[model samples]
Target chain A: MAFLQPLIFAIVTLTVFFLAFKKYRVIYANINLGKDEKIAGDSGTRFKNMMLLAFGQKKMFRNLTPAILHGFIYVAFLFTQIELIEIFIDGFTGIHRFFWYVLPLGGFYTALISFIEILSVLAFVGTIAFLARRNLLKVPRFHMDEMTGWPKLDGNLILFFELILLVGIFSMNTADMALADGKYGFAISGMLYPLIDGLGDTTLHIIERFGWWIHILMVFGFILYLPASKHLHIMLAFPNAYYGPLDGGANKGEIANMPRITEEIKLMMDPSAPMPEEDPNAEPERFGAKDVTDLSWKSLLDAYSCTECGRCSSACPANQTGKLLSPRKIMMDTRDRLEEKGAGLREHGADHDDGKSLFDYISTEELRACTTCNACVEECPVSINPVNIIMELRRYMILEESNSTEEWNLMFNNVETNGAVWKMPASDRTSWINELEAEAEAEDA
Target chain B: MSELMASGQEKEVEVLFWVGCAGSFDDRARRITKAFVKILHHCGVSFAILGQEEVCTGDPARRSGNEFLFQMQAITNIETLNAYGVKRIVTTCPHCFNTIKNEYPALGGTYEVIHHTTFLQGLINDGRLKLKDGGEFKGKKITYHDSCYLGRANGIYEAPRQLLELLDAELVEMKRCKSRGLCCGAGGAQMFKEEEEGKLRVNQERTKDIVESKASFVAAACPFCMTMMTDGIKEVEKQDEVQVMDLAEMVAKAQDLI
Candidate 1:
């Protein structure tokens, strides 16, 4: 019990430290947040979306086999917390019988533990399948691109984590088999008791302690390491899924109602109004996002929350058709750039070099290659809208930097002149509808 | 079509069929539209033609990121419909139906929009329209391309296929058909705009799949798709082997054969 108390304290303390570090580095940061304020407001629809996406795992289930395997593992991991707690208690008190008498349905407990044992094995098997599907199978459709930076290492790390979890679970079960004499709480562990009987008591105790420590340390390490890795989905997925737009709705068409162009001119000339360039300390006019600080807090959270699962890239029509744009890469670029900037600020004590911005780092060629398709958002398990981010960047490029594709400029001109993308005269706009009875009213009275 | 009028009020008018931009503009589509109108009339269903007065439904505008223009066109079309007292609209173009039904409501345009396939199916079920036994021309396997607006946006997959079945054509489906149908590089105004920097064209990819299916004929609900797929077929040098026809055209051709 005394030795187990130190383990408990270490786990709790580590959890607090992990949470604090995440809050400080990600949640408190203003630069990475999206510019949109409406995202913060609570809506019933958003809550429903969250429930469907997180608990229901609606998006994940799009791929049937993987979804089922992941579902089992997820549910088992959740319920197995009870077994972990019991292990910790038993290890500390040296009384394996503590929970044995409390459970009214002793048989049910045994059944549940046995079920968990089966589920754990299934989870291990699923992990291997996932690894092969991602790495060994080399499914061209699932292959990561150059922009998917460090995917091989990330994939291996996840496999390692899952392997460690499986090893610890089996070792714990073996230890439990050694400690119990006659009846056991779990069927699988009970079945293994005969095998443990041959091993001496001292050796059994050492193995039990070793398994306990290994399991605890691994769990703690996972918790602390989550915020830094692609596995950050463990913490951010629920919120990201919940906050996603409802019903996979299209983007709102209306622009923000700013001061009218007509009013701006009037105000500039009025004697009562402050003249242009008169006040030296006047706030700089911000047409679009100029830097990371220009983004909203939710956008920042989005950056940190990205799971890097490559689902977005896999589903992207543009990527599938051999376009330069990969939605996964877009998210990665933002996150990596932000982290780089954050590190720079930390190292240089706010005297950071302004030679390059995130835009500078992410090539314009890559940005222009995007078709503005919503496939990424549709397929994303966490519901991150990469299309919106790309559009925002486009807005910045056009309004602030005066950088835009010639096609966009021409299209915009055509739209401005003819009120149509085809650049036909406004008079001919109703030409196609001219023959229908509706045409009479469409024409001038 | 006669039964359709019988099911309605004593007035003989059954439906107001809307011939959209591509239907009127393209020669092949125009023939299909004329055939569809003639078939409907033959069924004893009285219908009114809007003629040249029927302008664009603003699908191209809305999809091309010109929302303002879409709204303007929507308002004009709605006012036109109100003036004509149009309660129901049957359209050959799925894009027109989607815009008039789904998008128009936001712009205060309200009218019951029905795709031609649905209207034709309803007429057939009600015994107004009869399928003429064509005895299968060319004995060619036919695959139906589900338009995005019709299939995914509005859930009108079965009706078109059902119409095809009535024609006695063997409906061969692609591996990714119906709800997961590949876009023919036409929707969202990709038809008018230059193709983005993708290695392969969307239409080419979709057409390649169609070619691989080895179906001699590809039928679609949207004229935009018909145009794109035909172009794709031509590009792949399968122009002589494969033909692109609208569902209405296929139905009309089958009716003529009978």
Candidate 2:
């Protein structure tokens, strides 16, 4: 069984990586299913944004308390990787404290472990605070209508995983400290060793082994669970931030232009321009997004990068005013539809259709309620433009389906014939000039 | 008003005054247009209007997902502006400012478009416009509502607030202002239709914030916002207590230009 332990460890590590990679491929394929968008240029600005937004967690600081708590978990996650490296080495070779043996530094190992120990304690506190926020405080954003079943559970599960992993690390360290008579001089675990010192060496050894097993097993579980979890944002946030809207300029409000529509309009407006060579077998270009595939790949990336934080929904005017539209729900629905279709396509062929589009998941009422004020886009801790998705669906409804409200139709008609949103003629546009002059003349009199 | 460039009559003006559809027709919004024009006139700034040659920029149409109509309107306006060799424009409406400044470039209309607030601020900077001491709005409580198009869409928050500061008014802020400001329910072409069934309208929610600020006057920058906030103030029964005035009107009063 002693020899079997290393064999089992290697097998488990390989299986987790294999499974996680398999799921990752599906996500990659699903994202590529979207229409191509040119987010590849401007690497300099994109890299800067990734650093500031993702690595720096700049947007999270919009609210102070959660930012600090999130900082605790984020910092711990980064430091935990140091200890994990040693754990992986020890598991494979069946030699405990592999780094302690290999590293040439005298007290460096103790100091590093002590720092990680302190961070783990803070991570524990952060996890508990987050759990309290979800369950006890029932923060309005966390308890929004869309966060009912799986989202709520997934959020709690993530925290619980963090909590349990912290417990496992401390348990192993404290027990190992007692067994080794506090040889490592690790701060938190060394302090805890005194209470457990009365136990015999064999008992301490058993406890240490048990703790080590659970910690390693949980690591594997976490990796397997992440792809299916909204917590995947941890991995996806960097890329999403890199590909987010970077033109913080006068054109930030401009929606993307459809090249097909541009070409068509250009041809119609100028008969002298050479006619486009038509391909009879080609499928007609979609006017706007009806299904997830019609959306740009960046939008699909946004769907995947969404952590279900509800920040967008919390700040959404439509949601604030109690409209059916919730930007968070829009992202969730996009991801849900993608998963449904992606899974089917992955199993069957690319031609596989679920007989359902994104409209099945997102209602027209929700789409119509959006103000396109960019409130949701601004509030998002990660850059997810729900307005872009809404506008695309709206474009589909208007251009492909010709479905629109009577008022919008009237406004369109007015713009077409009268050159205004109202029925007033274009000749009346400068009538105010006459009135201003008349009022000035009357005042002079 | 005589400064307007008449049909087929050419004059090299400093800038073109683009009176958007609301500023041209809506009775309330027309006053904003007048106030802005008065300021330009008082400053001895040479400006002209497209008059009947100008049409809607199709802001509402584009926002309502009618891209074809919007493009048609945009191309026609761009052609007309290009024909006149219009190099710079100043608009009282944020919608027109945003559409022409931001959206028109891709459609072949590229001109230096300035919002009235930014234009007025620039005038004050150049010593072209001066605010009288202890003017009509001196020491008045004024809260400026950030229009989505101007504030968030184009990052013009400080320019409007900066103009408000010159008024000698006690500038207060709503709970949501600047980048986080609430919508007045007229953006995204919602002005054309009734709000989709919600517990309350967006403008009503926004008006609640304005009332909470307890300001005597709410300054608006966009005609759509002007319409929404005015109706919101009336809906909350604060129409008598609080007034919704555009930045141009406030500035005009402060400068004694009207």
Candidate 3:
């Protein structure tokens, strides 16, 4: 019966993980379509960034204490898969010492098990610290606005899951140690073996079966919940870090020489002949991004992949200086807007036009408020480029609606007329150099 | 056009110091530009002025989402430089330096650009420049403002402070300075557009640190800093006591003692 339970649990867990993996793959494919261009940099730098950001979790180190604690948990979880496999095999056979043949360090198995138990304790403590920091400590700087759509029950669910895992680990080891009369490995469990010694073998077996079911269920639940929560970073972060833009390079690569609006309209008008106009329509067609389709696929990916960590908001100079702009909020808004649109699509079907797109949701003031500084991108743990979104919106505002700042219009005119922002007359540009005779002589020589 | 040097010959063209829009248009800033040029000449660099031939470098337009206009101006400026056969350019403005050196390449205008602080430091390093210690002016604690382009954007923070150090002035630092320096309200063409809604104007917030330092003078290396801080000082009503001066002007005053 014990063996049947674990085998069934394994099949269920694998099925759920496989389903989530498929869904995430589709989301990833849609996002890659939005990449502006291939980033240019030293290949070594890309490798280093991947190793540090993806593997090393470099960005998380911004919060030093939590970073270290989380690092221990991450490393321990990666290495402890051997323990998990052993537990699963033991569950199937109802024989705790079945893996003795595979134990290379026969006498040291107790020590290894003890070390894993200690690491699990450390991970539990670290998770508690993280929970306290987010909830009780209430770091206002990291708080997100409501529109960002953070899961409310996330903290409670994660904490409960950790507690369940700890209990499950301890109960299994304790039952095993009681059966062996402290002869087996698992020092911590050996200490607790006496407590469960008075219980009958049948009761001990029942406890072991219960622990196995709960632990397996928790793992499977976590896998299923991942795609629906900010915890999606567990899977998304690797690719996000790997494909991040190269540093010291153009924030966005070469601007695509998009066909002018006039040409597009002309093409539409004439099916056969090439249409040419000396001066196209008096009104310029929308040039910049006007809607969701206007956003590059990477932008849509950015929306879906946000962990809602608020690291971007923390790094934003504008946010620090008390601006309305929050890079985190921007990512959240994109995600929230998408969710709303998805709901609308489901309700009204694909052809539904409820007037709910980026145009109606994001205001001109909100768009213009962005300074196009890469602070948000620098701070984003998942490597979302909020600046690109703002730029695309600005392009829409400028080219299509001609709704840009009057100052820019005036500056453009000045440059066109007199070759500068100030529109200075073309006569007196060289007066300062006339005063420096040595400089004059250096020029003449 | 005859003022031009022949092609393939090393030209002794006067330093075509671009005063830039902020320097030439703002009154107090013009004083600093005049003083800066005067000091460069005093250091014996033969430089000719490109009076009307110099136009706006289109930095403001480019930054404000008007790249087309920026390109047009850049092209015109490049043509003017070609007409003058000018090879070397120096400016007190970090914006002009960044635009000319970094942005102009995209517009096919390539020229050697130097910020005045770096050029002045070169003069000091070579012993061509000297400053007479003023023995510390009374009621004057000076903190330097790191202009974004000169400091964070281009990494020219130390040269200006080095020049100040040579003047024997007390160099007080703001809470955030150098690589993590705060942006003056002038970058990204914030100078040209209406201030975006925020808790405080970025310039005013930065100027508060200058006030908090109780520094009599806020020394800066860029024309934008000079203009923005001066206006910011007035906005905060600290203009009567606290003053904003370019590093060159401060160096010029110290030079008078020498």
Candidate 4:
């Protein structure tokens, strides 16, 4: 088995990457199933957006306590990965602490190890804090009607996974410190070394080896689990933040900037403008999105990027008012529909029809309840726009289906016939002027 | 102003004041229209009315997801404005201000649109308008409710507050003001449809914050806000003590214009 180490590592690494990449390709292809949306321009602005939002976690701090804990776990986890590089090198080369001599920076290595040691412990604490927030604290934002079952479990599992990984690292380091005769970096690892003292070299070696293997195995497990987990945000947050609107204007958070319906209507209004030349066989342009394929690519990407955090729903006035519409549920339903249809495609190849769409999952009641106040868009830490999705569905309902509430239909009729929402005529739109003029005349007299 | 003058063939009017459907039709909101017009007249501002030529800007229609009707209304109004060669538009209603300023450009109706608060603030800045040193509202505790369209949607918080400061009112803020301000439950065309069943009505929750501030007056910038806040105040049985007034009405009262 000693001679089989390289072979085992090769086979395991290949299988893990193969499975992860295969799933990733399927998601990517499914996301491409939507209509093309142009989020590709302005690399400079996009880069700045990615840096500020993804790297800086800019919007996450609106809820301060959670934001700080999130940053703690987030920043410390990245630093702890420096030690993972050391572990990976050691795993492959069958040599421990390979970086200790590879760089040969004696003083710097000591400082780096000390810094990483402190962070690993902080990461442990942060993981516990997150777990408490989910399980014990029961944050109002975390627990929603739709976030039951898998969503609730997935959140707990992520924190649990991180907690165990940190324990393994510290256990390995404690054994390593004891073996080196109490010399330690940060010594968070060595605090427990005294408990198992005088256990003999072979026993300590077995414990060290056990911790190392467990930590490495869990890392691989996380890689495989992430795409299926709400933990997918651990990877997709980067691109989601990057793809966010980079204009940074007064209304930068607004993603209601759709391909304007007004433009096509403007063309139809111009009597002299020749009818737009189109191939006679070409399908009519979609009025509004009815299905996933009719949605813009960003809408699909947004579904994938949702971390099920419920920040949007928590901020939503509609949700706060006890409306059936929860923006988090909207995204969850969208992602569920996407996964259902994507699975069908995977099992039956391209052109496979599920004979169902996003509308079957998301209801008109949920759609109409939205105020379109952009609260969800603003509060979304990942910049996912559930309002835009609602607007898209609404467009389909109004234009294609023509099924709307009686009040809505009345307003629609008033707008079309009278050119205003009120029952008053459009010619009487400025009747206030006459009334004001009469009052002014009486005052003057 | 006639089309010739509106086209800059003469210099009688510098801007066209677009009083939206609410300002024109709703009896309570009509007073806001009067107050704003009085201020404009007192300042001798070069302004003219679109009169009956004006139609709804389709803000409610567009917001309620009737894009076809919205475009019809928008295109007709844009044609009317463009025909008059209207350059700068000022509206007492933030809905009209937001739609004409933000939404109309997409439909080929581009103009420099100003909300009444900003227009009044600009008048004060230019010394064209003046506030009484100690008007009836002097030292009165007043709080401004941010309309979602004006405050969060277009970032116009300070202008209305600036106007309140000039009115010599003791400007107090609610627990939630400015960007974090709660909706009056009337934005996004909720003014038209009935509110859905909820644990608490949004405006009532907002009025609780206003009542908590102990302000005698709640200043609003939008007609919808005025309506919702007025309803909320009445719901709490504070209609007698707490009055909901528009910014224009407050200024007009201070100046003795309305």
Candidate 5:
């Protein structure tokens, strides 16, 4: 039985790790399928931004209630993971509560456990409130159009998953505190111990073991579930914020990098500038993004990092005004198409063309619906810029596809010939001043 | 000052005041341009117009996703300004202000550009332009609509508000002000495009907010917002009760420059 236990533990741990690692490799490979373009700007500023916005949840605080609840749950889960590591070690060693001696920082261990206990209970309450807000209360923010179907199911399932973990944790603590004379903080769970107190010592030990295995197994399940879920933000938010376009700020019209495009245009315009050696045999350079591979790696990272929180869509002026554009849908659509492309590459190997892209999922009407007001970029707590994606697609539509509205085509013509949106010639620019001068002279007369 | 450029004479000034497309051509916005021009002369500040030398800043081109056209316009204007050794510029349009101030630097056209509201506020601060005590706008209920480029893009909420404060009118605020200020449906090159199909036009919704505010005098800082709000009011049939005036027009009124 002892040997069987170690064997089972090894198989389960190795299998979960292998599955999660395989998915991680696939995600990494798929992200690199995007074209190489550096997310330029000062690294120090980007780091500061990551710390302030992603880690600190600065944008989330705009709505205090959800921010507090979300923050509570985040911190609680982070702290509980420490206990998880301890449990994992216990599983491998065939020992129980090994942390009791391993974490022997004298009375400080009790304090630490006490703190974790309080957090666990708070996290429980927080998750319940969050679930109620989503399912029962139907908070408007969580009820976006793209949020239906799997996205909706994923939300509820994750909360239920977290609740299961919390139950196991509290039950284990309660069983442990009861079985032993008690040292670790069990204030909340200790109250529930009386109901199970009548069980035999063997039964009590079995129950504790049951709780321990359930908690650890659920954690393993969560790890495997991450890459396919919005919960991937748990591991991705930091890197996504760090890798974000440096100047796309929380204030004003701070937008994404067009440095490459800027340089390209400068080279094309400046006659004195040296041009790149033309490769006649190679394919012509694409004007703008058409496929997932045309976008930068950072944008791919952004799609993967999206938490599907709907902050971007909700804050979008176009979306608010009943336009087709929804920033959340943009990110979700990008991710969906990328995943499909990734599957194609996996099945066929070597950057296979699937004859489709983000455009396949996202409509032109939706793309053009964006106002580029940047409210979406500013509102994102994770620093995702749906406007950047929208702009790139728009750039493609205009430069490559020549697919623009009649008004835009006219404006383009005016800009090309008259150097303005209006057909007024360069000479006519001063016509307003001429009118002002005439009025002043008439007044004098 | 404008005639100096119009006369094809070489001129030098600390600031080259740019009257944008709307201010140059639109009848209502022309009033704003004239008011600002009068204030410039009243203050005895050295400023000149680009006159024929001036071209569009290509803001609409850029926003409308025509980068090639935008670059063409930007480079041409840059060449003209550089040839004349133009340094500082002030514009009455926030779209022009934003494109020139933010986008131009990347295109190698760098200049110290100031919005007219900020310029007017500076002049008031410098005691160059004086306002009448208990001016024509005195004790009136006035609310300001923030143009997106001016408020959110450039963070110039204070300058426009301070321009209004120079009047004796009571400054009222809408529920959505400052960073949360809504767009007036004319931004992002939507000025030239047909309105998207929706339950309500963006201007109508914005007008609803203004109507709910109950301020008779609606002060605006951008020509786009002025037009949109005017149309908004006309749609709601509040043309008799509500009057939309530019910040420059309001200031010029207070100073009796016109």
Candidate 6:
């Protein structure tokens, strides 16, 4: 029956990994539903962006107070992985603190555990502060209109999970120290041992076993919950940053040229040009994005990578001026619509339609309210371009549905007729030159 | 005065003044165009306009999601520009500057494009242009409203500011300036259309920053921003105190040329 312990640990770990893998596969497939777009820039630029934005959290420094608090949790979460290796090995070999013997140096394990102990303490404080910011302090960005129910709960849930995980870690370390009687000499737990030392050996052993199990089980639960939570940003931010627009791309206010439209326009403008062959069976290409399938895969990745921080919304001109357009809500709605369509795809075949499009999730008013000022794009910490998604959706509304304001329609008509935004003709484009010459003559006179 | 090239003149010049639709046709923006042209003449830098040959760069059309119309204009303009072997161009409007500099390369129209402020900065840097001592703009309190296309889009926050720095006026900054600058409610072709449902107008919100800055003269680089900021000042009932002046107009005033 001694094998039962390792067997249970093995079964639990395998089940968690399988479940996480299954969810991840579905997410990957859902993201692939979007149209393929070649991300501009070489590997060097992408790698540099990933390292600076995702790993170094460079953008997080824009707001100093939250960045420092977040840094405590982020840095601790990274160092916690070192201690996790020991936990997994101990669980498999039925040897508590297995690295104690496996590691080459004598004091290395003690030093590493002490370091983890110090980090977990900071993580515990950071998690509590985050919870207070959400519930007590009520940070405006965290409690916006879109963040009412699940988003609010999701934010708190992760913080609570971190707190519990830290509690479990401290429980295991302190009890193990009490049992050791100054042998291992972990810094934080050594100080804590006196409080729990009066509890006899048997009780201390049970507490250690209980805490060890709880910590590992909580990690497994976090893994399964990640794909369903906005916490997925923890994994997706890297790839999203890597595939973000380069310097010469959208950042320079360059709207992507529609190649299909370009080809058609070229053909229409010149009769003498050679005509290209068209396939009869091929579906007509869409001018812009109408749904998740019409958007670029990079846009879908942006949806998954959104942390729901609402920095974009906070900085948006439209949102700040009390308009309906919230860039954060755009990413959230895209994710929601994608998930709905993804579920439909799983049930029905490739041609699955729930009779709902992105318009059903995002209203026309919200789409139209965007100024495309790139404030939202610049404010996003993870390089998620809400403007890209907004532009695609707006393109769909205008080109596919011909849904537009009368003013926009008039502007469009003017441009088509006169080769300018206003109703002025091309012949009058250089009229200012004459006005200048007349003004110069008047000045001389 | 430097010689201004006429369309199909067959004469070469140092640069081409791509007078945008607003600069050419719009009454208010024409003053900016004239101011820049005067500065060009003051410095004796030879330049030309395409006259009837130049059309809109289709900045508004593309931003409004009318790609077909935008491309039509883009193609037509590119043909005219490429045919004339136009290599260097300068524009008073940031919209035209951004479109020709960033978006035209893909459609086979590439040229050395410079915004009017950047062009002015170069003139000042080269010592080709100089200002009179303490002219109309001297010692005035001025705040520059950043154009979205010129600032964040093109990473040109400093060029306009650099031009402003040469003025004897005290240059004060608004709360939201540079990369974090608020929109004057005129970007994305919004100048031609009414704003979508909002509690307060976008430019009104931006005006609050200008008002907070307490500057008398609002310096603007883009024609659209100038219009929006002027309207915002009117909305806030500060038109009497706060005046919106373009960089070229300010520089022209300082040089006693306008």
Could you tell me which 10 consecutive residues in candidate 5 chain A have the lowest summed lDDT?
Answer: A248-257
Best by DockQ: 2
Fnat of all models, as shown: 0.09, 0.68, 0.29, 0.47, 0.38, 0.68
Q: Write the per-residue lDDT of candidate 2 for residues A200-254, one digit (tens) a residue.
A: 9989988898888878888889888988899889889999989887765335577
Cα deviation of B49, candidate 4, in Å: 2.5
> Could you tell me which 10 consecutive residues in candidate 1 chain B have the lowest summed lDDT?
B1-10
Tens digit per residue, CA lDDT, model 3, A352-434: 76676676767777666664444466557667788777766766676557787877777667667766566565544444334
Candidates' DockQ values? 0.13, 0.73, 0.27, 0.52, 0.50, 0.67
Return whichever of 3 and 4 wins on DockQ: 4
- What is the per-residue lDDT of model 1 for residues A136-186, given as tens digits with 9 covering 90 to 100? 888664565742446557756877787787677667677767666735556
**Which is the better candidate, 4 or 5, if ranked by TM-score?**
4
Q: What fraction of native interface contacts does model 3 preserve?
A: 0.29
TM-score, cand. 2 vs. native: 0.98
Per-model TM-score on C-alpha atoms? 0.77, 0.98, 0.80, 0.94, 0.93, 0.97
- Candidate 2 CAPRI grade: medium
Least accurate 10 contiguous residues by lDDT in model 6 chain A: A245-254
| Model 1 CA deviation exceeding 4 Å by range | A1-21, A24-32, A35-52, A87-98, A101-105, A146-148, A190-197, A234-236, A240-306, A334-378, A381-385, A388-445, B1-113, B122-128, B133-140
- Relative to the true structure, candidate 5 reaches a TM of 0.93
Better of 5 and 6 by lDDT: 6
Candidate 3 ranges beyond 4 A from true positions: A59-101, A106-116, A144-216, A248-286, A296-305, A315-317, A337-356, A423-445, B1-10, B13-16, B46-50, B78-89, B110-112, B130-141, B155-170
lDDT of 5 at A59: 76
Please provide, for model 5 over A132-247, each residue's C-alpha lDDT reduced to its tens digit, 9 standing for 90 to 100.
Answer: 99989988769977889999999889999989998898778888877874656566666778778788888878888888989989999999999999989987888888887565
Q: Candidate 6, after superposition: displacement of residue A360 in Å?
A: 0.7
Best by lDDT: 2
What is the per-residue lDDT of model 3 for residues B4-49, given as tens digits with 9 covering 90 to 100? 2122123575466777876666556666776776676577766655
**CA deviation > 4 Å runs, candidate 4:** A1-3, A252-272, B1-12
Candidate 3 DockQ vs. native:
0.27
Candidate 6 per-residue lDDT, tens place, A1-445, comes to: 7788889999999999999899999999999999989877899988998899999998899889889889989998998887788789887887767777666656987888888888888888888888999899988888779998899899889998898888788888999989889678898998998999999999998888888888999899999998989999999999988998767233558778888877888889887877778787988888788888899998999999999999999999999888899999999999999999999989999987889988888998888888778888887888898888888887887888888889999888887787677888877776777777888799889
